[model samples]
Target: MSEPIRVCVTGAAGQIAYSLLYMIANGDVFGREQKVILTLLDIEPMMGVLEGVVMELSDCAFTLLTQVIPTADPAVAFKDVSVAFLVGAMPRRQGMERKDLLSANVKIFKVQGEALNTYAKKDVKVLVVGNPANTNALICSHYAPTIPKENFTAMTRLDQNRARAQIAQRVGTDISNVQNIIIWGNHSATQFPDVANGTANGKAITDLVDTSYLQSEFIETVQKRGAAVIAARKMSSAMSAAKAAADHVRDWWLGTTGTFVSMGVLSDGSYNIPKDIVFSFPVEIQNKQWKIVQGLNIDEFARGKLDITTKELLEEKEEAMAICNAN
Candidate 1:
């Protein structure tokens, strides 16, 4: 058999990983034909939890699974991995300010990033799934200087999926038919879910939906969908999040043709976004590399929404950098 690809998942014992690990092992990200070696990472205290998770995986006896390595050490987790899901981060506790959450996660990502730089394969493709994901991705790439910035991305695919579903429901079409929805800016509530250039079954979304709904209800629903899940379930969205995370890396690994997906990649001054911060944009993947989709006209309404999200991202950048500099 060919050598199995090494894949690492941080926060492997968490709720998200509980669902994600199976998908990775059972050919959700990599193709079913591709063999995989899974490396799972969690804090020392969560090692017990990971043991049960591993046991379940073992019972499944996946034909494509080659190995599973569970560890608390980042260096051990990252070493030689070809693909990484940086899913672990300090969760926001009650009474914690936004800055506090950012600060804690910044420290965690810095350590993991440094480990990734020192041990992970040079070409490792990383997806940041933790909250404050775009800024966390920035901090991770900042510490992992050897890994090209393009290799680090934040998960905005969840937002994109939500937007597509909403558009599909309103227009009464299969969600698959909705294309070109863009989740612009941060992974936070300030992110803009844009359908300005989107189409549903070869027809413009604008032509089907009035501007009032598009400008208000549709935008807010996608942006606040996470909160809605939390309010109803009394916990965050895990199953859907894990699914989206898997879909994200799967698309990135295999590459997408004739369509684009939303990903938070490092900005290179594209579409008036400032350079170096991780901003979500509509991107097309080819040959395992992604290029941001260009030439979509940003009208006045779209430009204003973009600016709002951009401001939030810049504020997030400043806050994260301040915390990093202090440490």
Candidate 2:
């Protein structure tokens, strides 16, 4: 058995962490053979709630959970951590614009980023799960100047999973049948869930479904699925978001098998997206490192979609940068 590792999850008292903790404790992420020390961090006011969550974790009798560190201090939570799930940030409230959320989250991430830089492992893999995630991640990386830009990523896997499910439901096949469904650009409604290169059961998705459906309904549904969930449930997606975060870490750690997966990695000028802003792209993982898949043909329509989403990210990046520069 390998040495035990520390995993940190911020916003430990929140609904998503409530669902996510069990997944990590059960060894769904790092293999069942590996032991994990969970560092659950929330604000000072929420430590009482975190204590209850820790009690529940203790009762689960998971062999892989060797220790649980519950603290309000970023220093304690981030110290020597191997994998950090940055789930703690101010959520968008009623009638809040993206810029408002960006302003709030940038400050939170700046502190966490500094913590990661000062205390975390040099190679710590960070995933930003909060809203305005891509910009938050960019700002986080900006603060942690020593950490590699590739180490920070935002969660667009949720959107990717939704796209796959919609494709499967429409094509009358299992979700696993759809591979390489790319979520281009941001995590918001402007995100373009491109299926141009995706294959369903070794056949082209465009061939399996009508071009019109893929172009119109498929794009709109995947883009607005989160809002639909919020509308129906009166709460944002928690369990599904947790599951996607796990999938992302699992794939990133263990390496991808057959097809490329969607991830919001820092843009490297791929597909004409400007560098610095984290943008979702079709990526393949190998040796615990993710690289954007290259050389896929982008038709005019896909180019237009990418440009639209890139515009949103650029604006978001501007807002986040302004906050960082001020503070």
Q: RMSD in angstroms, all models?
A: 0.9, 0.9
Question: In model 1, how many backbone clashes occur?
Answer: 0
lDDT of 2 by residue, 1-327 (tens): 688999999999999999999999999999899999999999999999999999999999999999999999999999999999998889888899877888888889989999999999999999999988888899999999989989999999999999999999988998878899999999999999999899888899988899988999999999999999999999989999999999999999999987889999998898788988899999999999999999999999999999999999999988888888888
TM-score of each model, in listed order: 0.98, 0.98
Lowest summed-lDDT stretch of 10 residues in model 1? 1-10
Model 2 stretches with alpha carbons more than 4 Å out:
none
* Model 1 RMSD in angstroms: 0.9
lDDT score for candidate 2 against the true structure: 0.93
Model 1 TM-score, all chains together? 0.98
lDDT for residue 308 in candidate 1, whole number 0-100: 88
